[model samples]
Target: MPMNRIQFQPGLSMPEFFEQYGSESRCEAALERARWPEGFRCPCCGTWAHCVLRGANRKMFQCNACRHQTWLIAGTIFQGTKLGLTIWFLAIYLISQAKTGLSALALKRHLGVSYPTAWLIHHKLMHAMAAREERYVLSGQVQVDDAYLGGERGGGKAGRGSENKVPFVAAVSLSDEGHPLRVKLSPVPGFTLKAIAVWASTNLAVGSTVCSDGLACFSAVTEAGCVHQPTVVAGRKPKE
Candidate 1:
């Protein structure tokens, strides 16, 4: 068996992360660059001319045209945060880079912060991630499948009808070269045509070509203005 390229790809090491964003100043600079790639533009007046005011805690940008003042972290997930940018950046790095996901308790220990602070940080980051994901709709050639979470308990029903199972729809968009792009895994109430139609309307863009197994419910994607291409599994395994 060969190693999976995606799983084995090189990633930023702890030392490398520290080298780039170890200091508060470095993290702040990085955030500024990310927020304004071209340069500072006042959010209120959209002017590039701004003056930096030295606050006791952080720098504030004042637009010369509109006299509007905004903090570096204003209107962002890091807004009004009392924590240092370095700490927040480190938390982001840890949460995003963790393979098995990082818990709030573990994050607290890592950042040497209070449990409540860590929990709040974790919640905010997760909410930000979810909000960003909600804006994305898959387009072009998309592959979709029905999935389930959990398994039957000792005394419960088995297989697809198991009481413990929660149904979900898994969709992956592919590029022109057939490379995978974005993926969406959304939970549905059940594998009914109505459920599939609702999920398709929310997740798929109009005119997207959706390929899925011969599940009758998937035909409902057509109701969402997407083209559904069904493939017969005929009891063969997915790999086959």
Candidate 2:
């Protein structure tokens, strides 16, 4: 029984993250720097000069030219979010560091926020990630497979025909030596042709060779401008 070794990537530890972005002010300042790398350019008036309103704790940036006012999280995904930036940052950290992924319930317990807020935060971040992945095109040889979750039943029908099963696609970009370079596990509504096509269009790179099990939906990859090679697993013995 040989042990399977895993390569771990370097990441920000909890103590390090807290030391830097522990406070709300620190997080706000970080966001401001990220939003305006050069300097503060008013979103509305595009003015570089702005004055911070002093008084009731909330820092409001008022454009000197147009007098337009905005806050740190304004016009971004965190806009109108009542939760503090620290909580959001913690959620992001937990989500990123988790191997199996953190559920909304788990997030609620960890962040001490309500279930609804946790759910909202989780989905918002997930949706933003999905949107961002739309620009990725996996080049070179790739392997793809269909995966399912929540398809089990104790006293009823089970397996693929089971109710409440969630379908997702698992794909990996392979190097020339047949090693996996990157992997993606994306959830889809269902494993239909349209769904697979949509996933392929967004997640896969054009002109890549895709290898997959003999699933009909995988043909949709060709429609997305990629080559598909389906391997028939039926009646094939393990390691054959």
Top lDDT prediction, candidate number: 1
In order, what lDDT does every prediction score? Answer: 0.91, 0.83
Clashing pairs in 1: none
Residue pairs that clash (backbone atoms under 3 angstroms), model 2 = 137-205, 138-205
- Tens digit of lDDT per residue, candidate 2, span 36-147? 8897888887888989884345567899999998886777788888778899988888998888988999999999989999999999987887777765767789998888
Instruction: Score residue 57 of candidate 2 by CA lDDT.
Output: 54
Model 1, position 29, has a per-residue lDDT of 89
| All candidates: TM-score | 0.92, 0.73
Worst 10 residues of 2 by lDDT: 1-10
Going through the candidates in the order shown, the clash numbers are 0, 2
> Which stretches of model 1 miss by more than 4 angstroms?
235-240
Compare the candidates by TM-score and give the number of the best one.
Answer: 1
